[model samples]
Target: MQEQEVQRGVLALLQRIAPELEPAQLDGRVALREQVDLDSMDFLRFLISIHEQYAIDIPEADYEKLVSLDDIVAYLRARLPTS
Candidate 1:
């Protein structure tokens, strides 16, 4: 998937997890939990949403690598098969 598409997907998932967050407020480089008030459960839900969307298995050990919007986009992009 394209970067913008992945970003939009992340934002949409985040909206479900934290409705109060505005897409414009997200900093690509900042950690999602630091930028938002999402707790551990909320964060897990966000990750699950991403996994569901892409049908990609994100192992628990790699969860830390997806701490930011940029990271999530890149991580998912790399895992997705290029068609």
Candidate 2:
């Protein structure tokens, strides 16, 4: 998948996880926790959901890199096997 497609999928996944968040709310520069108001546990849940959905094991150390919507997409794009 292309990077743009991964970003779109990440955005959709986030919306599915957090219904309160709209696509407009998540930009590349915005911090996921600060901008989205997700606490640590909430973020963990979000990560778990992403992992479950994508069948990708996102390590905790890698979590630091996932600071925003763009980051999440990039990380997933890099880690997920391309078809």
Candidate 3:
């Protein structure tokens, strides 16, 4: 997917995960747990959402690489199979 599409998907999933969240509340450079106020389980669910959406395998060790919206977008963009 394109960068814009990836962005949209991330934001959409964020909304699904936290309906009370506002898009402006997320800082792309900040940790997602900080921005979204997610506990360990919540964060795991968020990661699972991304993995399910993109059909990607995300090992536990690599979770840190997806700490922010920008990070998630960049990671998926680089790893997603080309159509």
Each prediction's TM-score versus the true structure: 0.94, 0.83, 0.89
lDDT of 2 at 33: 78
On the 0 to 100 scale, the lDDT of residue 46 in model 2 is 82
Off by over 4 Å in 1: none
Q: How many clashes in each candidate?
A: 0, 0, 0
lDDT of each: 0.89, 0.79, 0.85
Q: Give the TM-score of candidate 2.
A: 0.83
- Deviation of model 1 at 36, angstroms: 0.7
> How are the candidates ranked when ordered by lDDT, highest leading?
1, 3, 2
**Clashing pairs for predicted structure model 1, backbone only:** none
Please, what are the lDDT tens digits per residue for candidate 3 over residues 27-74? 788887887878888888888898889899899999878888899899
The top-ranked prediction according to TM-score is 1
lDDT of candidate 3 at residue 10, scale 0 to 100: 83
Candidate 3, lDDT over the whole model: 0.85
Q: Clashing residue pairs, candidate 3? A: none
Note the residue pairs that clash in candidate 2.
none
- List where candidate 3 sits over 4 angstroms from the true fold: none
Better of 1 and 2 by TM-score: 1
